[model samples]
Target: MERVIVAGGGLAGVRTVEALRAQGYPGRLTLVGAEPHRPYDRPPLSKAVLRGELDDTTVDADWTALDCELLLGHRVTGLTDVLETTAGPLGFDGLVIATGASPIRLPGDGPQHVLRTIDDARALRADLRPGARVAVVGAGWIGAEVATAAAKAGCRVTVVEAADTPLAAAVGAEVGAKTAPWYAEAGVELRHGVKVASVERGGLELAGGGSIEADAVVTGIGVRPETSWLEGSDLTLDDGIAVDERLRTGRPGVFAVGDCAAWWSSTFRRRLRVEHWDTALNAPEVAAANLLGGERVYDPVPYFWSEQFGHMVQYAGHHPVADTMIWRGDPAAGGWAACWLTGDRLAAIVTVDRPRDLVQARRIIAAQKRIDRSALADPAIPVRDA
Candidate 1:
């Protein structure tokens, strides 16, 4: 490819260029970023950035050495043979769509915030002063992390969740409920089985005919892929831009990765669109290889990590709904692990404050090995041995 134009200069887009160069694909590279700032790390936006532990979380890289044109603050409006950006149309021999996702917001408005960018985190942090009443909607990863930061800042933080427990959709009610007490321990009120009807001037209106008075409301329900610009294109778009195992879109010279791409995982035997840092970091290598005429299937045991309420939580592999959950240690204790098994075969694992279990489980899951359930349940037994 003579000119490879990458849209959405987030982690995936930046990594695409990096991988292209690393693979010795010498060509004209252009990175079009929607934000004015250069590509930066996003995981810290909720944790360190919101807590003022970090002034900036820009992705540490020397762009000068790479030699690529970066168009910041340029939003892509449409796509065809050429990308239609806010600046102008630019043609490409190869195109990479790494637009990522945008956070879902509440219906109405208050002093609302969503943690998706550095600026978003900064604004939320400013509002989260000592004694400021903050109501955070959703008890998912972003919600929990933001609540932790707010509580640490001495804000009166309350988390409202429509489900019965935190992370119900991800880990299920039984397993997710184990994290409920952590909110209280962090001095953040946990309001389960509650829904926000609307956000008003003072605070949030509850669906159950109640109101939460707060100085600020932060919504972390979820995010949708930023693929509206590709509406009229022939590219297959489902929950995200649908791509095959090779990360190639239906379009010949175009490919999608990161949060914007729902790629078929041969390993998991399904299509998955993961909105995590590891996917953003690793998927581009496969996408860039394919873009440069190499056959590399993008099948990986998905992994992600989160830090909330002074605990490090990590998960690996796709835990199928039907998989039987096996607990390694007592959840009542501080650290534990829950392993998902498909008839003794390790499918996935979720660990809280147990990095060793996560590390070992990742390898076991990747290898598709079967382990003794009895041994796995024994906390004394190492995961590697199991």
Candidate 2:
């Protein structure tokens, strides 16, 4: 490919450019970023940045060496053989769609906030003053992290989750309930099984005939792929831009990666749209290789980590609901891990403050190793041996 245009100048987009250059592709690379700022680390938006520990979370990259044309504050409106950007029509021999996803906002008129960008974090941080009433809707990763940061900022935080427990959709209700006490310990109210009907000027109206008074509301329901620009494209678009194991979008010279790509993972035996930093960091290498006529498969043991409420939560691999769950160590004691296995093969692992388990679990899953459930349950037993 003589020329390449990468849409969405986020982590994934930048990584794609870096990978292409690293693979010795001395082509005309163009990166279009909607944000005025360059690609930045997004994970810290809810933690360090929101807490005001850092002025900005801009990503550390050797941009001078990459030698790519960057189109900052440029939005891609549509796509065909050429990208229809606000700047104008830009043609490319190859295209990478890494538009990523946007946070889901709560319905109604209210001062609602989300932790998606540096600006968003700054806006939210300003509202999180000491004793400011902050009602966070949803108990997912973003919600939990925001709540933790707000609490640390001395805000009176109340997390409202629609499920019976926090992270029910992620780790299941049983395991999620184990973390309910964490909110209380942090001096944040955790309200479960509550749905927000609407957001008003000073608070959130509950569907269950109640209301929560808050100075500000933050919603972390989830994110939807930013693929509206590809609405009439010949490529398939489901929840995200559908791509094969090679990250190809059916259209020649077009590929999608990161949060916007729902790649069919042969390893997981299913299509997965992992919206995590690790995916954004690692998937580009494979996609870049494929863009250069290399048959590289993008099947990774999906991994993610979160820091909230004085705990480090890490998960590796995709664990289907049918997998058998085994707990290692006493979860009630704080530091422990839950291993998911399909028959004897390790499927996934979720650990809380157990870095060794996450490190070993990733290796076990990558190797597709069979585990001794009894031995794995013992905290003293090493995962490699188990």
Candidate 3:
């Protein structure tokens, strides 16, 4: 039997090994992870775990009994087809790089936090107090979620973003403009178009010589793909390790998945790296299959969800150049669907507190079918039917 070595035993690594077995690949699979703990779900790390709704005991996975060896807490210092780890030199016929990202940290003084792991969430959650002034450095998904959680815990939240609108880069201007009011309604002081110059002991300095007082600062600025170990490898790295449509890297007998992998997206016809939990979980199925001699393609509709300030935001599909924005209901009304259309077809949809609409919009994107603009704007009409 062939031997397969999996690096970075997060969701993608764990799932890929399980998938290899499920696909009848009778190979010796070894999973190496930097974290000491076993592979756990990360989405909950930001939401339920951070809010004290879940515990560490509940984060354990059910696949430990699989026919594989797990090198937990071991970091792969170098990669050469033969990895040099803290344990020793290990080799394999095939390798899968699934190392995820780390939270961006600011160089500063006291008690600043970034929620990426259980320890991080626990530390931040414990320090959160009612009526404390909480300042968030970024307005991305992580920033919004943390700010929302802080507000719910009775803390005064202030979100600072360099962009003119929050989430302008991810979701377009039209959508970002409408969604901006949620911060003020939730009692959060939203500071837009301001770049953070530096962080001091008491507060953060703004670019234009202003300052924001912060009792506790939480930075969710962004995350870079964890691919530094592959510096000597022959794999191409542009933002991430560039892989083919099958998730195979430039080298033979090697594959990459999750945030560290920049694979070709058939839906958008471009090379992209997705960092969402869903992508991390589902992309491995394709990588494993392809690695096990089954031809499989990693074509997926990008889907992600974020919960904040008593509202659930869900979106699917790629909306790079959405020329028109269509609204099914009023966001101020709490439950509504916002659709982004490129020319005539559905490019993407952001549904606030509406799961069914997001699901239907995903189907529309997958089908590559154009929806009637009027039908999409009407709440009475179902998105699937449109």
Candidate 4:
């Protein structure tokens, strides 16, 4: 392909272009993004950005050496014979869909802040004044992180969750509920099993009766694949753009990666749409290879990490496909890990402030070999040897 257009000028798009050139595709590459700023890291937006510890999270890259055309502030609008953008129509021999996901906003919102961009973080940070009452809707990763930063900023923070516990939808209730204490320890109020009816100018209205008064309100209800532009197209859109093992969509010459893609995983025997920083960082290489006519399979053991309440939470592999969960240590302790297994083989791992466990589990999980259950359960033993 002479011309390749990468939609969404985020981390995934940047990596896709870099991968294309690294794979020796000497062609015209164009990076398009909705944001006006250069590609930047997003994980710190909820942490360091909000804490005012970091002013910029721009990705360290020499765009001049990449030799690709940059289209900032250009949003992909549609696709047909030619790719449509906010700028104008553009023809591409190959297209990489990396438009990523958008944060879900609260319904009937008033002064609702969602952190998905650097600008959003700055705006939210500005309102996080000392003693400012902050009511965060949702107890997920984003909500927890926002609460952590707000609490650190001396704001009276409270997290509201519709589920039984924080991260109930991600990790199971038993494991997720264990983290409820962290909120109280961090001096942030944790309210579970309550749905937010609406967000007003001051605070959130509970689904039941009472209301929460706050100086600032933020929602972390999760995100949806940004595929509105592709809705009119013949492209198959499931939870996201449905792609095969090679990250290629049914549409010829079009590949979907990043958060906006739900690629079939041969490893898990199902489709996975990983909206994590790790996915955007690694998936592009395979997508780029396949886009350049390389028949590379894009199956991966999904991994993601989150920082909340003074804990470094890391997870690797897909636990939903696993059958058993074995704890390495007590969750009440400072550092602990849970191993998800399919029979005797490792399927996933969840580590809380246990970096070494994650590093070891990742290597062992990639091997796809069975281990002794007793050995794996023992925290003192090496996971690699398990």
Tens-place lDDT per residue, model 4, 1-386, is 79999999889989998899899988898888999998898999999899999989988878888888999998989999999998899999999999999999887757899999999999999999999999999998899999999999999998999999999988888789878999999999999999999998889989898999999999999999999889889899999999999999998899999999999998888999999998899999999998888899987778889999889999999898888889988888778888889988899999998898898888777778777889878888878744
User: Which lDDT value does model 1 have at 180?
Assistant: 97
State in Å the error of residue 16, model 3. Answer: 1.3
Clashing residue pairs, backbone N/CA/C < 3 A, model 1 = none
Model 1 residue 70 lDDT score: 91
lDDT of candidate 1 over 31-120, digit per residue (tens): 999899999999989988888989787887678877889999999889877889998999899998999999998898565898898889
Give candidate 2's root-mean-square deviation (CA, Å): 1.1
**Compared with the true structure, what per-residue lDDT tens digits does model 3 show for residues 230-267?**
88878898898899999999887889999889999887
lDDT of each: 0.91, 0.91, 0.84, 0.91
Off by over 4 Å in 2: none
Clash list (residue pairs), candidate 4 = 9-33
Native-referenced Cα lDDT, model 2: 0.91
At residue 359, what lDDT does model 4 achieve? 87
What is the total number of backbone clashes in candidate 4? 1
Itemize residue pairs with steric clashes in candidate 3. Answer: none
